[model samples]
Target: MKPLNWFRLVFSFIAVTAVCGFYLPGLAPVNFCEEDKITSDCQLHIRSRSLLQNEIQLFVNRLDSVESVLPYEYDVFDFCKDEKEKRSSENLGQVLFGERIETSPYKFKFRKDESCKKVCTKTYDTSNKKENVRLDFLKRGVELNYQHHWIVDNMPVTWCYAVEDGQNYCNPGFPIGCFVTFDGRSKDACVISSGFNKKNTYYLFNHVDITITYHSEESESWRGARLVSARLEPKSIKHNSQENSQSCDGPPMDIPKETTGILNVTYSYSVKFEEDAQEESGWKQVHGDVFRAPQSGMLLSVFLGQGTQIFIMTFITLSNRGALMTCAVVLWVLLGTPAGYVSARMYKSFGGEKWKTNVLLTALLCPGIVFADFFLMNLILWVEGSSAAVPFPTLVALLALWFGISVPLTFVGAYAGFKKTAIEVPVRTNQIPRQIPLQSFFTRPVPGIIMGGILPFGCIFIQLFFILNSIWSHQMYYMFGFLFLVFIILLITCSEATILLCYFHLCAEDYHWWWRSFLTSGFTAVYLFIYAIHYFFSKLQIQGAASTILYFGYTMIMVLIFFLFTGTIGFFACFWFVNKIYSVVKVD
Candidate 1:
């Protein structure tokens, strides 16, 4: 490569990095702080018809006004022997366990309720200064979404301290709680003997618990952090009350067993003030980073949409091996010059009538197949309320962009090819293409495609499980960097496996390497589909016809993309081997 070209690439990358690193902070979405007993920041955006169709049952959780309190619904198993027994009926009734899925937090709107509007205006005005100017604030009703989290093992217990005659302070914890509210508000409602304190304001003295609950497909419910432990730090905040000993230094707070049922590896939470985003909510853009890892199979589809474009283009542009990448490079040297130029030469080799089919199919078929799968799978996720579906419009645009560029390139090469003479192979074809090489399942295109998937899968299946868990399970998938690397590995494996198979087939005199290579590598997608089916059936018990259809719908998309990526590797690899072998032969 020319130094200037290299310099440009490096400079371009640097420029992009600078912009993302520097300017992004300001451009990035703004986040607000929340101070509830259990709080977390996350997003579950829905976008597209397929996704919305599946998730129609889930209404938008919003807090429209201040006078509203979000009603959270949860199922109490009624099995907890006592408060401490709020866990699964395991060997030990004292064990605690559960789940938590923190949906995206809501950004409170400034729009006030009608009733609160008048009071809000009057309360802030500093007009008539008499009667000690006492500011009497009205309690405006607000709304909250019900967040559901499940706890199977470690049940939650509450620890309380008697502060006033009618008020008390409570925290979620057990055993020797050490950590305090490293982050929480100073004055928030606290639950005492009666549960959550709605009418009383128990000044937060020590710590706070922000239990982030999100949906989990593994246990087939929502789950999050069980009370690991916590401490109360009264000295951190500025207290105006005449109380020197605001907090007592004790061993630790141990919540009693009676409060355990609330931890039933089962809980629910909705949303409040959701009108702004709700006018449109379904499959929103996916967040969290995308990367490759040893266990990155599950994220294959998620990362492909974002990184595939630049990634493949870079690979192709950088390799710039062009004819060198094919077996033709060797043929070019043996027969010299144009004899081994693959694009033009193979264009002729495929026969004019079939050339278009070959190139077009090679370029478009794989992506088309993958998208079909992707579209279908997205429908399934949409139904199951999973976020696996890539928006159809975006997907179509992506396809158009890829094929539009690639189609012309292939045709141009073909035109150049058909106008040229046939490549003089070191060995000439007989009256007809050779046949009769019976092979094992591991060698033929079909079985080879099937087997090629195993190693790549072995490298990533474990990771894929987690990825699928994060997606269907609704867990956090912020491990894109690691996944990206695994993507690289899968690429290598696909290419090498295809190449090895192609070389073997050619040595066996099987010249029909076109579709064979594509199919062989593309077969990996089949395995992926199989695994997905296994996951859905064995791992997830998602009810509803929508969920079933959506699962397979998104699974198909994953399969389709996988097909393209793997097929491309195989086709290119075999193409290289063919050129190299023919070029080396002494075609006299």
Candidate 2:
């Protein structure tokens, strides 16, 4: 081999070795139980703990929010528990989702009934200047409608309140308090109470009483009492005078909008345990409201519609490969209208005059490229006489799905989208564009786009390994929940990374963010393709050129879909972020 060829060979060898070394099973992160149970210091306590009966009581407090100016506790926010303690262990998914599982200070024996159990209390002296400042901070947090997210036993500790239609709703997170505007308009959460109707008043929840229920194991088959449920009610009480003391049961606590002097705020909570045969599932009452479609642009709605169909197709194909193609065809045909409508609507909003071109592109652009790639791969398979080659009739059916049903539905959607008025942009575009200055290599669009994908790629690469193993190595993929969780994480990571890069570019005076945002996140597929190549060479032992082509051809299809999915996520997120920031600013 030539000198350059030798260098390439050596580099490839090292790359493959490094990938294999890092991904080896023994080098993987230790499971939570494996690390704890196998260690001598933390011996297995499951057997010993089985003999004892215990009831789980969660002490919730110290609620804070990013948008808020104050951090309040159970007593301050009228949430459950009096004091806060250390949190418990969280799984990888929980940590990624920002779940806080705090440690409980109250662990009771099974069937134990306790009354007004005092955990802790905080009494502030308004005369103290430092205390006054702290109270002011707390007041501001409530005004912002910042929320508190409390967790118990790896699940959210919910706050149940009455809603419309004589129904009750449980919210996973509750606000510290709510602000009433100077014009006597109560905030969203404050509207639940008529006592909060006072003009320009701040209502702070100062106390919460929690009732916990457990089911004691009485039979020989089981030991100890397992917590069945926990419930809490918030009370906001106003203490008019020092002699009156703190009473949780009363009208809403009113804080002066402009307090410059002495302020007394008392915080306390009461907890009790009872053995009950009945069980209550927390946060279920709000299921209808929780799953409501979030506010987003038309494009996102269309994407979601299409994504739902695709998810269904994927789920079906997992168990029924015989009808995979047929199912996909039908789903595409049914889903095409929304896709086209979304594309046309977005295009029209961008002031595109070429309706026919936009509609055709929406229907054919991605699918055409994919089909062309597939055909080329099929030709190779045919030439090699491989069984993997899709039959000509199957190809015809696919085309029929594309041209007959999918195409017509797309046109219908496009017409519908065009009939509707284009979405209004928050900020007016300047007739004259701002000139971008000279940029460093790092700040340039291409490099930024490439770097934008790395974090998202990193987030999903570990999960991707298992997926690829299932696909090529024939291993079973049963962890759908974990896969779905990872999928969500991947989406979040891609959107965030792209948004960061887009912001940097905007700051650098780059106005051409339309396609850049998409490409920035879409580039993750390129890394995925590279990893696939690395895996094929290092991990797989397939010998034939035809099988290799088939592998790559199928892989390319996956890569393309992933590209669109991630690219769409990034584009919409950046679009929303840019519009929001620009709309808020006073720009000429």
Candidate 3:
């Protein structure tokens, strides 16, 4: 085991926070002013910019093959904004880099007051856009968003509705949602009336057509595009029933076509803002049905309302990084232990040995170390009374529940193991564990660790950026369903990669499967770190020590949990695969 081998893994995870975190010197800092300090004169003016972009989701071979919903995480503002300054789309360097110029056009700030402890808020309207993605409680739909900035030069603005898009502009993207802007002329027109509401802050998408289609391969347009019913979900608004059917009394749904080969579904969301906020003091918009995803609130809020499932599934949000995360985190934190134990027992039943080793690593070895930082980081948030810190009692309860459920499941798995057959891998193995022949560094576990990261990172780097933005950058993340799907994809990818390497090592007569599983899934933390570093240097510019320390401190917690999550996945997968093969073989 080379020293560099292990160090690289650890390095990749920490480097991002070290550089991109809030405390780094020479960068725009988040000026978070407490509500108390903000005076009646210091009005909180907000501008909401709504816009639309195109996306294409391609399915490769349909089954077993990975799919891609064209990674739309890139900055569309930079992608399209500079066409005016350069007089052409070809030269977009301004919007591409130092995006501060484009966003600075619309600014809002509160008066300085001393009631606050730390004014280092964050790049609130800084990065890509507001995070507003959510999954329907019925577990049937997804909503994605593109944020257009609604800003003014001085006072921070507020918006109750999702005023989206400058539809009348040159090269204007196809308008779907509401299309009201500050400036409709002079190409790069400035904002006169921003996207803000008196008391509401959620985006109000107008002209927003939310289309849901159901198609079967046997249908006419079913080749690539599915032909299904499309209608916008009914909102709390009363619009003319002319465009849609007589008016849906309840939630709108897309039903599958009668024909069948295999079903295909398509959901499209684009927007055009209605006439500017009622020139008076009322919420007004182009009267119509823009298909909404179901929830009009934050991700956590949406998911938290499990009791009001139907209600939460009615509209799209302004952003969704946190929403997407809600389901995944809930699933993992709740299921990690139980699954680990159940899978372990299944392996044992299949004629496996080393039960204690596998169970111990799953229950304690990984989780114990993973959570160590969480406890400490809570202290920072605790002392400051910052929201980042989870209450100690909550932490204790989480631990108690996680272990209470997972620990017993492990024993259940062990018992199940005692009742089942011995193990069997596809091929035979030597009597003793053979010494692996060393090749280049890449061929060893180090290479496997490095190689394992590419696909996982490719699939998740976009989402990861948003997550880091949420945690360190203080951006919201609420696309839990999408995130959950991605999480599933990543789990599959991690397991496959680990299995491929573990199989090779096993064939080579090396039997150190325990650590290898950890290394395989754990490798993702390395890539996460490296990306964090890249984002820090390439994307973020921070200032101050407290922010910096706080940044890394929190990041360590992310890395550690990821370590356990991925490691557990890999180990169980490899364990199951290994046992299936070893147990079924003839061992005379």
Q: Encode model 1's per-residue lDDT on 1-588: one tens digit a residue.
A: 964477569769987995675433213322211223223222222121111111111111111222244322122211112222122233333222222111222112211111101000011223434311321111111111112222211223244456778676664422111111224221222322222222222221122222222222222222221112222221112221223333323222222211222210111122222122122111011000000011222222222222233235434433443442243212211221121124334445433345555445444444456556656666666666666556678767665655555445545544565677864443444443234357665556666556666776776787789889987998876655456556667777877887787666555544555566667777777777888989998999799777677677767766765665576566666656655544433222
The C-alpha stretches of model 3 lying farther than 4 A from their native spots are: 1-337, 340-362, 385-387, 399-422, 426-430, 435-442, 476-485, 499-518, 541-544, 568-588
Candidate 3 on 1-588: residue-level lDDT in tens?
A: 643345456667677765674442312212222234433322232112111101111111100101223222212222212222311122367345422322211111222111101111111121223411111211111112232222121111222222357332221122111222233221111122332221211222221232323222232211212222222321211222233333323222222212123211212223221211112111011001111111222211111111111112211111123354454444444444344434454445333455665555555544465467667667766877788678878888878855886455545544554455643343444344334455455546677777776776678888888877876667777765566557657878887888887776655444555566556766888888778778777767777665566667667766655655566567667767665544433222
In candidate 2, stretches whose alpha carbon ends up further than 4 angstroms from where it belongs are 1-329, 586-588
In order, what lDDT does every prediction score? 0.40, 0.65, 0.40
Model 3 is weakest, by summed lDDT over 10 consecutive residues, at 282-291
Predicted candidate 2 versus true structure: per-residue lDDT over 1-588, tens digit per residue: 754356458769987995675543323321111222234422344434332223344544356666644555444532234245565565698566555555444544333444433333444456787776667667777877666665544356678898789899987667777889999998867887778887877888666666665554452123334455666766666543444354455566778777655555554456666667452222222222221222333333344334433444554444344554676667766777877777777766766677887777677767787899999998998898878789999999889878988889888988998999977654455544445568778779789989988999999898899989998999987766566557657867988998888777766655666677877888899999999999999999998867887889889988977777777778778877776555443232
Candidate 1 wrong stretches, greater than 4 Å: 1-348, 354-427, 435-449, 506-511, 585-588
**Number of the top candidate by lDDT?**
2
Candidate 3 residue 78 Cα shift, in angstroms, is 66
Pick by lDDT: 1 or 2, better one: 2
Candidate 1 achieves a global lDDT of 0.40
